[model samples]
Target: MDKDWIAYSECVWQCRSNNESSHQTIGSSQAFSVNMASMNEPASTTASTTHQSQTEARTTSSMPNITQHSLDHNPDIFTIICCNDSFQIALDHSTIATLLRVCKRVRPLLSSKVPRFHSWWRNVGLWRPNGSLRFALTPSEQIALSLHCEYEGIADRSWLDNQADQGNATALFFLAWIHQIDLDSQQSVNKPKREAICQQIIFYLEKAAQADHPMAQYDLAGCYRNGLGVDQDPTKAVDMFRSLAECGIPQAQVALGGCYENGEGVDQDYDTAIEWYSKAADQGSEDGRLHIVFLRGWFSFIGHGVEQSDADAFNRWHEVSTNSTNPVLKPIATHMVGWMHYLGRGTVQDKPKGVNIIRENRSDEFPLGESESLAANWADINSDSPALRKFLGMCQFGSDHEWLCKHLVAVCLIHGFGTRQDQEKAAGIFEQLANEGHSVSQLWIGRCYSFGKGVSKNDEKAFEWWSKSANQGNSYGQWMVGCCYYSEYGVTRDHTEATEWFRKSAELGNRYGQNMLGDCYKNGCGVTKDIDTAVFWLRKAAEQGFENAIYKLRQLDQWL
Candidate 1:
């Protein structure tokens, strides 16, 4: 018989149990005998079934010749047949039932021969409800499938432990990952439990690393570097990072660059660091790009690894300010940009615009006003040291609280509190805040301009800021405006304007304002000459211990 006919005959015989008894056999007994003879005959002669069944006894005698031993002894013939695509397709449910019915010996032999049957099932997208391909199989069969499938349901701790005990590298790596995740999640775990978990993670990670798992190698190196369940070994960490960097892992490249930059485990080499950082940046690593920018800027600024160039520093900072998405770095970069602009370092000096940019980008939270009780006890709180207030203010600044932080920083700059006194910086900060509508800052800015503490003395600027503060109803600002008018500091000497501002300040109970108003009345500079009104204002100032007012009153009393 032809090989195709024999395979078809075997399928029909095996599938006999699936059909009604009437449809069990595919052809007459004579045809089966003739086909069986054709298997043994030479290629030249064809076995004719029509007259072969004339003797029923001879046809029945050929049935026992097709035994299991005949097929099993020449198993390669069956193997070739079964390995065919058509054979596999035909070996479905009904065919399997038929094969079992035709000969029980064939089933066990096929099972032994085709050990990857479950793998084939998986390859064909067959999945059980439990995610195991061997759903209908016994526990032993499931275990056999698990060895090859690596299914998620089969990856419990117990199974992984067993596999790891048997030296399965993949199982060891997965076990390490599981333990690491557990340790990270249970922060409040007991010390002993945490240490135990860490040790297990290290043990498995090391085993997997030895097995050449790249992620395990990276993680194990980190453990060594940090002394987590391992001795601190910077050399080993550097070696691992170097290996992975050669493999083009971006994170490893960055780590290797850091090692070169800091001389942690090797000689410090700026060229090597830059090379590795560039490699990581090419791979789209943000930290790599940031480090490159920072390193280049620092080197350019100090002429260390590169020639000093403020323009290069400015370009790097400008890029960070404009393009970086990091919240903290962006603001810091913006501040640097403003500083460069103000100092004319690689940029034209534009103090007003520079200060404005810094003020706008700086933090917005006002920490000082957050607590009313704290504000009430400010004097007592700051009595310990002159620098205490400055330190507290910088803490707020570092925490991105801008309003009170700027005020305190300016105060520090003015008084050399906890830092070098920089009158120009102080004045700039005050001016920025003043423009932002801070009444107190406006008063300070006016004072700075009036006294030339930082910038050259400019009386008109002083009056302008003081006038803004006064309009905001600041009593000190009103008094300063009066002083400006009285001294013709910015505006023309206008005693009437001075008296009006002094009266406004006096009504608000400012001692200096009361004294100034008394003087205006006594001299008839603005108000009508009225000794009684002058005496009233002077007494008010005297109550507040204004010595000039008291001395003026003593002279007036002696004259009276």
Candidate 2:
């Protein structure tokens, strides 16, 4: 009923009006002004309360006090499980409160049956501890959440202030989250506007964290960790991580594990570090598993509380590279293993084998979206995307897998992927790897010799390289060798030899080989013609969506 509340409302409207460029609702202040220009209430006044009584309440009682139910839903566990994180992070605003005001917690039958120990409430806004959130939108919060300042749901400063006054921890965090969203980096800001925004965030985060809001506490730890709003205190950061870690938060567990490993706040305790990492790893935390494995490798040679041995270190890193499927960690570990092998520090000196280890590790994504039977091509990778830049950098360094790096560089040269296209350089690189007995490179060099792509077209040289790769069990190479034998490109036409090579490739699941073998059978080039057998082989290739196989099947009038 006091003028202070009215004065505050006016101030908020004035501020909102000034911030029109921020894309907030333009004239909401004027509309709200007429309805709430009086002494006490805006629209939420005494006159609106006595209209109806709930079945659970006395007829004389105003509105039934509903138990705290939340419309503020957040993501689950850790997306660092990635819905698991991506989906939850995308769930910032919007609610089902519009369609039905009946929230899950408001359903008396459900509420009594199951206890909702939701962690999402701590991250989002509005809890049952005020109004009901229907299955659709707006216990008023749906309105606040689903809109910007454009509609009734907009959580402008005044709305959040009111919710915060009502002891809404989520509201407090939201006020902070939305304000500093633009300046997401927690560095000390120089501009007055940014400084003010940072200060606002600190104010709300501190208040909400004090109220024991889980998200607020999580962010508060970040502040200390980054020295943003609070003075940098490794001890405080450690304390916060320890608290959340105990609550079964995987991110907190990893953070605490890192702190222990690095001696950030406590003495170096590798055992304790491993313990926290194991806990997080149990919850499927990749960082936790990675740290545990990395720690073993780090101290294996350093003699930090463990017996130092070069071989032991190499084994530890090799285990990581061989066992892990993580895209980032696996390559790093594999590189470490290759380097150790090359240096002859941990294992026997075998430079070619060391290079070969990296060479074989790139079966997956070697061509990286090039569609020509897993070979490199003219797919556009020239954009300054982060992934492309990182990939190009990795290829340039050649630190972890030298031969693998050369192969990728050759691919880049051929396709101009994040670099200049140079057919000659690519052909040279392929020839080098082919001499090193790299099967894929042997196949590529064969193609280069056959097509004169940076090299003289020579069927004999192409047939020679293809034979080498085919001997090493490259399926595509077998098909190429078969082609050379059938076409008499480098030697006399030998149908039996061509048919045998095609059979070998077909058995290894090469669609081209299957199609060719079927054709050989159909024409009796190397064996007696058998229409049924030819149909079987052609159908197999056709099932894999090979275009040539489908055409052959159509020519034979076979079911495809």
Candidate 3:
């Protein structure tokens, strides 16, 4: 076999020691290359056939006349090479070299026929005993594979399309990644546009997945689960996830574990979920390890899956809050840890340390959804009256947002979280903070006057307070002001003024503002009736998990 084809052959690409912990990087004289005893001739065990086959190979190699005519005439050759089942995948270099010599002959046909590329990779890809690699890379593949730069969408679509047209599996996978999936788990396109992009993504993913691309398989399963580009099929998602999980893909393992955990397409089996999570954790996946800890915590916290143990829950939550590499759940975990510490549920009681930990999380750095902060009204407070009073005093001294910290105590008083219901006390705190020039407190006092929660129902006062906060550039206050103008709740209905306030608040990244702005655009309340603009604003808020925005986007989908 000639050196050029031999150098790029899958024998060198896939051959590795059974015990190899990593990929066998290609070299001129590595495992498969060692079969070449001389510069011109490859050493082979089948000595009788080697000389004659090499002679015939050199003759065939010189003739680049492979075309439709050749393919039509050589039907037997097509069946032998084109069929994935026919591939024996011999370990020796001579067989691979000869196969490449054949591929070289059929290069013109294979370039346009994408299916042949799929069959080629499936037949030639290695199955390591350790299951470390999905497919061993050729040097060109290694360079092409680095194109997945999340920050830079696609530097050159034509270049990648060229590679994909030439039947490059890596290129197909990247093309899929680029088309529909955004880095932040938000699609850049609105629903109508996303549907089209999702089709393109699924097309490329299927081609690459047919070639045994692991990431493509994982993504395709995600599509099935969420119905991104297709119908929701939990069975298909679970099936695909199980295949990759068995092949030691950590993300797939975690996904499979979740399927078992939640009984999505399978019977609920906590033990099985734990096993899968453990396997992923063993492979050094941070999310996998966290899942294991969380499962144990959940069991103890809920007292259903395993014997109840507050100590176990506290320890696991502590580990997640203090030591986990994944930041996704740290804020929630820290709060739980602090609450338990203060209550002396598991460890020795340390009120000061618990207070300190809770206070530390009051910073803007914590992951804040539309609601759910330490000061937010809906926090699951189980602490008693004495403990609540201590929290109230501690809240007053917190370094971040003094008014918000005090608002927590007010919410506790109103809700009777651990004290008697007292709206008067809550309204007193709101009025005092509003007088102190706190924008959020002004918004709260406005709500009190509008709803008559703790103050006399007064629309004029509500609008006045809302205006004061809006003038200070508070996003929530701005949204409230827009609402009053739009609905004539506390002011004369004025769509133009409402639109301006919504625009200002929406630009500041408030979900409520975004949803309202979309509403204005949808009905042409102030802005022009533009469905595209409405969907754009609504989708932005929906991606941030706003329920109202999500509902609006669903309503808009019927038009498309």
Candidate 4:
């Protein structure tokens, strides 16, 4: 074998070993055997020397090459390498370097030949005895091998035979985990293959994590974070993230930082976000870079948690805008770039570019149809307005306006617009809005209770709140109270009293009150019936889609 290939092979071999000493010892004997055996095969075929034999040899020789071409297309490279590494570590006590070397050689071999055997080979290599690695592993190593085989999604009968040969506590634990994950006692949804795999992973992960494996700690954190085969708890997730972060894992550092920034199972602290981001950033994390930029820009702009410096803020954003290789960072950078252009802050004046960037980032979001139209309409209403803030708030609430469909859903419930006159639903929404101190919502809630439009009737509660709103000069509340007395909903029936209230509401030119008064005169409910007066008020309310007035107007003269 040439010196360079041998050296490369040796390094690869080391990755599969438990330690440096093991690599040197293992490589000394097996390195040349593999190189010589593979090299001699070509010459041996050529020496066969008969036309028929030569043709047969050529076809068989080309078989590996054909398989190699096919294996190159399988896209999941990283996952395979990781699986191989995990097996080697568990079985032979091989280090990552040795595993990498084995993978480099075996991947091409498996890729060119029968790629289907990659998982099987990995499991075997993981459990293989140190000295007799080419054949079989020790009893304990075999159990780890079996668990790993199941974890990698293998289901061949031969694979089961291999597992039974090494099955032990480790294998049993892995099986239990696989069962727990894939088999739900309450549901028959678990597929046999996935159930078996889940049982194995859970069992092993629990055992290994308890034994202080960094990978297990990281995985446990993820399990808690997502409630994967376990209860989800952000606090437990943070704890796990912290433990793993202490061990210097980049992903754990990022996760821990997220907990600190959002106050999820931790205190909200920008300083901590900055601190954790820095730690992860030092390890070349793309996410860390993006977060650093965001935190620095936000803190610098507001002069909170970090020192004030617009130049520094823009510089941080500009750095991420230019430097990061992460795909997720691209959209975030585009968003911040758009903001900079829109505000003409630190960056060159370029609204068109900013808009383009925003649109580009928007491409990743849900397809906007009528929601875009609503946004455009909303924008046209106030060009120099803070509409972006409202839109962003909606996004935060998980209701992006992707459809642009105009929905008076909230208003419809309030005024019995579409489905049904639901005062209970209306009151609930009013309460929601009123809690935000929106005067319109507060007034509507009072009216809903007072009239029992879709809710049970309440008089004292309505009157007390209405009086407060009236004192605040709420015109709608004033009109609503007047209409209540006029209709005699919760009060004693009295036409004179009703008229007095109607006149007060009418002076405010409340169209609803006008329509009500018109009803009174037309029906002689409070005053003498008068068609002319009814026509006047009905025309006013019809313009607002008031159905009552429209019906009344058709009777007047067909002038509606």
> Candidate 1: worst 10 consecutive residues by lDDT?
370-379
lDDT of 4 by residue, 432-507 (tens): 6655554545665566666664557788767665655555544455555665566665555667666655655555
lDDT of 3 at 140: 22
TM-score of each: 0.36, 0.43, 0.43, 0.39
Extract clashing residue pairs from model 3.
none
User: Which RMSD does model 2 reach against the true structure?
Assistant: 16.9
- How does model 4 score by TM-score? 0.39
Worst 10 residues of 3 by lDDT: 31-40
Off by over 4 Å in 1: 1-171, 281-289, 307-311, 314-560
TM-score of 2: 0.43
Write the residue-wise lDDT of candidate 3 on 83-168 in tens digits.
Answer: 32223222222333333343344222222222333233233332235532343333223322323212223233565577677666
Could you tell me the lDDT of residue 405 within candidate 4?
9
lDDT of each: 0.61, 0.60, 0.61, 0.49
